[model samples]
Target: MHETLEIRLTVNERSEAVRIEPRETLADVLRERLSLTGTKVSCDAQVCGACTVLVDDLAMSGCTFLAADADGRSVRTVEGLARDGRLSPVQQAFIDHAAFQCGFCTPGMLMAATAILEEHPRPSRDQVVHGLEGNLCRCTGYEPIIEAVLAAADAGTVDEGVAGW
Candidate 1:
């Protein structure tokens, strides 16, 4: 029988305490336990970036990250991108630019873009490309995504209303 470990963490600005198996990944805890399914799981080896989530404001692969490792940390999933009822700048930019096709990679892409904007508020085209290189999208051909990020930056919405977590 596997032992369950008690962990306390913050998700989407809400505090949570959960009993999870030590071997459980952050993706499993977020999706199955916490009911936050916005974090997708693809290429579980962390190569696809489909499971990207923000831990302490940095992009991390949820599928490869242990839930226990999230104890005392703040995790932000795609579902948390919007606050109140307004869409985040990145989300809006993606929509305005038609950055996604199948939408399977949208969540990770959004998180990655958010992280990039946070790190480099005015990232150049090459910087945006480099920042999002970890995420793989079969649709949109990457141009729309880059454009969306740039748009978000240009609109000055990338950092607006976003907490420092």
Candidate 2:
């Protein structure tokens, strides 16, 4: 016999009530249960930031973050970065700077950048580097990604059109 718990969470500005097992991770629940695949699961050990998502406005590793911990909180995934069919500033900057190659790490990078921008408003290059140090990306070599983040900060509206704050 297995035990399950029901949790209510707000994801991407949408409320979701789900029955989940005690051991289920937030990444699995979000990807499988809610069909939000943007929160990718790479190194489930939290070494890589591929599974990063904003939980209550703070960046968290979704793979290691238990679903139960997300109950009663607001979650913001890569899909929630935009507003009204428009891409968030960070997302647009990524595209403009060619920040991604394989694109697997784009979602996580974007999320991390968004979180940092929200917290610091205008982050320096070193601050951006320090903030995103946990995220690993082999495709774009991080130069473009860093530039994208800086450009996003320069846009001065990184947090304007986002959902879930």
Candidate 3:
């Protein structure tokens, strides 16, 4: 029998009811089902933060999170970070600092940074590095990314509504 699982999920502050396969990953559901393509999938094994998404308030690897596990929970992808077409401060800082290139890692980087800033608010350089340890960016060097994060923290310019920080 073809089983259709009904799952209710919150994305970008909007609730959705979806049917997914038992084995489908959260990333799959986000991208294919919900069309939230901002969440990328690199290494599906959870080592790479490329598929990172906020599950509740914790950063999680969406590739490993089952769609069923995410049911009725809030999931935030990079797409959800912007409000009314305005980018969040961290996101704007990223753009202002030119922290990304090639862009494969941007989504995960943003998610990781969001989690970092939320936890630390004003994290040390090492803490920033440690927070983003799992995320890998092959295009831009680390300096720009670090600078961007520091700038966002220093400015205290984060849109509280966007990140809830």
Candidate 4:
């Protein structure tokens, strides 16, 4: 049996120390240890993007990341995006555009979209599509997701659109 490694992770906005086996995945740590189950684990191989989360502001697959690898890194899941019960712009855009259907893919989509907007605050349609290419939504057919990203970029606030709600 491999010895557990003491790892410290800044999750959401709280600091926590967890003992993780060297082989344990970040997704497991987040779900099983911290109880932040919003970060779903679908493709353990890291292709589906269903396990995506923000690591140091970059979108990364939790399933592919070792728990120890996240030591000293700030992790943000979908649960962290909002403040005081208010949804973030990206999240709000998703709601406004009706971007999700089953909602299983929304977390990954939001993570990817957040990363994309970090690069291009106001991305073009093509750029939006390109940025979100990594995330897959079997239900929405990609149209609503694209529109939601654009809408979030445009409205400048997920709750307040370009028209400033």
Candidate 5:
């Protein structure tokens, strides 16, 4: 039998404990164990940002991140982007701007954008581009995504409450 380790972590502002194999990736744990499928797993090499999730308020590639590494830390997936049924500013911006095409990369883009907004409450266009450079999207040519980030910043939606998760 494969050895398993108990992992305790905060997910979407909720405390959770689960047993996971040492080699399991964060994406597998979140999707299989926790049932948070918002963080997609693709390009297992971390080249595609589909598995992006926020770890301690920083954007991380869930596909390549070990579940054990996330123990005792906070993780926020796409499912956590809403509060009390209200969409987060970043999420709203994506919808308002229609930032996604096929939508396969939306989750990662949202997580990365949220991190960017938290780090730079009022980021410039160039800054927004630079912040999301790690995340790739084959749809919308990125113009709408960039616009959405700018719009979210302009709306003053970046707040400490959103960053806490």
Candidate 6:
């Protein structure tokens, strides 16, 4: 039998205690065990940023990140981007700016953008570009995505009371 570890973690604001193998990746636990499939796994090497998720409000690649490391930490997925049925400002900005196609990279891109906004609420255009460099969009939809991020910043949507994210 594979040695397992019992870990307590908060995901999407819900608390859960789960048994997992030490070798398992956060993406595997989130997708397989927690049924949070919004965090897509691609390139599995932490290069594509497709499996990006937030651990303690910091963006990380779930695919390569160990699940055990997330113990006692807060994990946020793309699904958490909506609150009370309203999309987070970054997600809404993605739609308003038509920043997604094929929808593969959107989740990672959104999480990354959320991290950016959390750090720099009013980042410049170049800053947005640099922040998203780790994420790869196979749909080649960068312009609108960039515009959406910029618009979200311009609208000043990342205040504490405004977004529970």
Residue pairs with clashing backbones, model 4? 89-158, 155-161, 155-162
lDDT of 3 at 86: 79
- C-alpha lDDT values of all predictions: 0.91, 0.90, 0.88, 0.86, 0.89, 0.91
Q: Worst lDDT window (10 residues) for model 1?
A: 156-165
Put down candidate 3 lDDT per residue, 6-96, tens digits, no spaces: 9998987899999888999999999998888999999999987999999896899999999999899998899988777877778988999
**Model 1 lDDT, residue 59, Cα:** 95
Residues 93-149, model 6: lDDT tens digits: 899988998999999999999999989988999999999999999775699999999
- Identify the superior model by lDDT, candidate 2 or candidate 3: 2
Q: Which candidate model has the greater TM-score, 2 or 3?
A: 2
Once fitted onto the true fold, the runs of candidate 5 whose alpha carbons sit more than 4 angstroms away are 157-165
Position 73, candidate 5: lDDT: 99
* Candidate 6 to truth, TM: 0.95
Candidate 5 residue-wise lDDT, 93-115, digit = tens: 89999999799999999999999
Instruction: Provide the lDDT at 115 for model 6.
Output: 95
RMSD of each: 1.8, 2.0, 1.9, 3.1, 1.9, 1.5
Candidate 3 residues lying further than 4 Å off, grouped into runs, are: 157-165
The superposed Cα distance between candidate 5 and the true structure at residue 72, in angstroms, equals 0.3
TM-scores for every predicted model: 0.94, 0.94, 0.93, 0.92, 0.94, 0.95
What local lDDT does model 5 show for residue 134? 79
Segments in model 1 whose C-alpha atoms lie over 4 Å from true places: 157-165
> Which residue pairs does candidate 2 place in steric collision?
none
lDDT of 6 at 67: 97
